[model samples]
Target: MDDDDDYWNTSETKAKAFNFDDDVLSTQEILAIGQKSYSPSGPSEESLFNNISITTVQSAAIPLSSLVSSKVLDLILLAQSGKDPSKETKYEPEQTVAMTLKRLTLGRSCSLHVHRSMKSKTELLDGALAIGDGNAVLTVVLFLIQTLNKKLVYELLSSRPVALNHYIAFLQNEGKISELADLLTMLGRSPEAAMYQYQHTVKTQGNNVDVLLRKLTNLLANHFNQPGVDQHQAKMISDYIKLLEWQKHVNKPDLKYNSVIQWLAYNCTHHWHEGAGNAMSPLTLCQRHQITPLQYDWVVLNVHAKSGKWDIVESLFTKKDWFGRTTISSNIPIETLLSRLSQLQASKQLLATCVNKVANSDDRLRLAHMYKIHAVVIETLAKQKDRSALTNYKMTLNPQSEEYILAENTLRDNSIKWKN
Candidate 1:
């Protein structure tokens, strides 16, 4: 055995002496080495579980119902302890919805959980819309607007257009027009936003006239000056502002033509009182603002005339000729003035005054007959020596009337040459 141990020892001397052909082990020897090398299987389950505490074993042996009940108790105790205040107490879906909606009705901010759960938000919005509770809808939308990024919020509003409309209606109903404008601007509808502000300002007119005018001017200069706004619409707004300013200036007691008639008596009657710096005359303001002369004349004739300012009306048409005579240099046709004045129920004297301004006899006669200005008709007919026209004019009037009698005398006179 000692010799065999020395032979098996892995030394360089023993290794060199070993010959592979002569020292080859027999089958029984190889079998004996394999059997010695074989080891026991893994440890038994008893050894593995032996160190586990008896308490742990007993807990694992507990019934499934008891295990579940313990979990419930743990949850209940955790909730009562308020260890996690953010964790919701209610677990049922219906209860969660009721609690959220109740908060919204009281004008409270939406719960944070809805910010995470898309379905929850949709259901909440639907509930608000179903009941027509605008405040509630606004609450949810505002919450989304605050929590979400601009791109997401825009997508949300774009996809759910009803929510946007409800929000707009809520703002409008609350008279929060500025907020409404902001909402429109956020949605990339700036033109609508500008117009919205303009319409509201005009509609309310709650401010003083000067204050209102300033607001409109600000809108025209700043808001409507953007690239997307329509130039034509801005021009229209500018004209309206001009007209409003003109109307206000004209209504001033010191500026009214009747009030200023004495001033004109001594001072030369320059068009728009030309030399008066900072004058608010119709012609001055209109020309300065590029408003057309026709528009200025129309407003003066129609609006000022209705207000019974005949001096102002006459001053607009009154112009100086080379002979220093006052002539009615009306930019509008005399016929149009007559028709408009007639609709305004102007007196026949006023109508005849407009008629006598016509330079053409034919136009004057036709307008005079149409407007029943018999004096103009008789005068014009006599000047033309139209006995047939005079006779025809006589039959239309009462024989006892003065105008009819004059026509009869003119026709009977043979001293004047009567045209056939």
Candidate 2:
């Protein structure tokens, strides 16, 4: 029995020794344990706990909170009892404020305590603004607006224009356009405020076209015309007005086609009279509006022809100047006009007149083939006397073999070049 008891005691001692060795942490285990103790709850909550854990670890390479919590508590207690922490230590005011702000960023719980611990309103404002987190600064601003004087809150926000702009953007994103406009107006940005107001009005009263137009006109005359207004902004407003006018006219059945035509005519005439040059012309507008050149020419021709304005139609085919520059009325190619005129045999005289102006041999040949004008066709073929033209003319002759060979020989003889 005595031997058994001694053996049992030895085994128990060995077991305790083994457990103690297991509990002794290695260097890596020590680091992991330290991190676990100070680490935040989860990744989603990282922002709230970043300054406390990861940032602290990166700066100090260790968890200072584990080593210094008790001492910090004692210092706080002493400081509350009329002892200054800075006076008894090397802590500077800037360092203290920075540390406090970092702690406050941990969460609402830390924020409440740190906010109360701040020495003054100025320190709180400076700390919050200095952090530069949009949501955090917004919370601080709301707190100030609620608990502090309005004038003081305004002063604080005004001092940080970048933060103010961010807050304004946040409000706008939240669909609080009215509040954004009011805030902009308070900041003496009347033009921006008016723009926001106009946007809001447009979104709400979009169906009320006349009212919206009047409101826009008023805004342009009152706010946009100011001396300090941006030139580009003014131009944008003008373009919007033009777009609105176009949309308004296009929506009406009676006004749709005529309005566009009239607008094109007015712009072309205006550009010509003002010598704005060729930057904007009827052809350009037609192209921009996706109107085909044929369709455009047809409109001009039909309108003038119906109005008994043959002079305009004639000018459309007439050569205007030595430079070959012509008015919009005279812009159609002669070949195209002749092809169109050939479709109406009553317009044969007009077709002949246009063909007389043709300067290119291939173009005259093509027109003659297209219109079956025998005189022009024979004349053009005789002038060229090439194999292709001779073959073409031979095909046109009666199926008399003798006549065909005679015509071919005549063409070949004409094509022969004699030595001078």
The candidate that achieves the highest lDDT relative to the unseen native structure: 1
| Candidate 2 segments whose C-alpha is farther than 4 A from its true place | 1-104, 109-119, 225-227, 231-235, 252-420
**Candidate 2 lDDT by residue in tens digits, 1-420:** 698677757967555332335644333444444444456662444554566766454432445565556654455455445555445665534434466556557654343333443245557657777776666666666666667766656666787886687678777778898677767767778778777766776676667667777877887887678777676786666656654665574464343324446646555444423332243456655654555666666666755665556666666645556676442334567666665566544255466556656778788878866775555555566666455665677788776665566655655574554222
Model 2, C-alpha of 58: deviation from truth (Å): 54
Query: How many pairs collide in each candidate, listed in order?
Result: 0, 0
TM-score of 1: 0.46
Clashing residue pairs, candidate 1?
none
Which TM-score value belongs to model 2?
Answer: 0.36
Cα RMSD, each candidate: 19.3, 19.2
TM-scores for every candidate against the unseen true structure: 0.46, 0.36
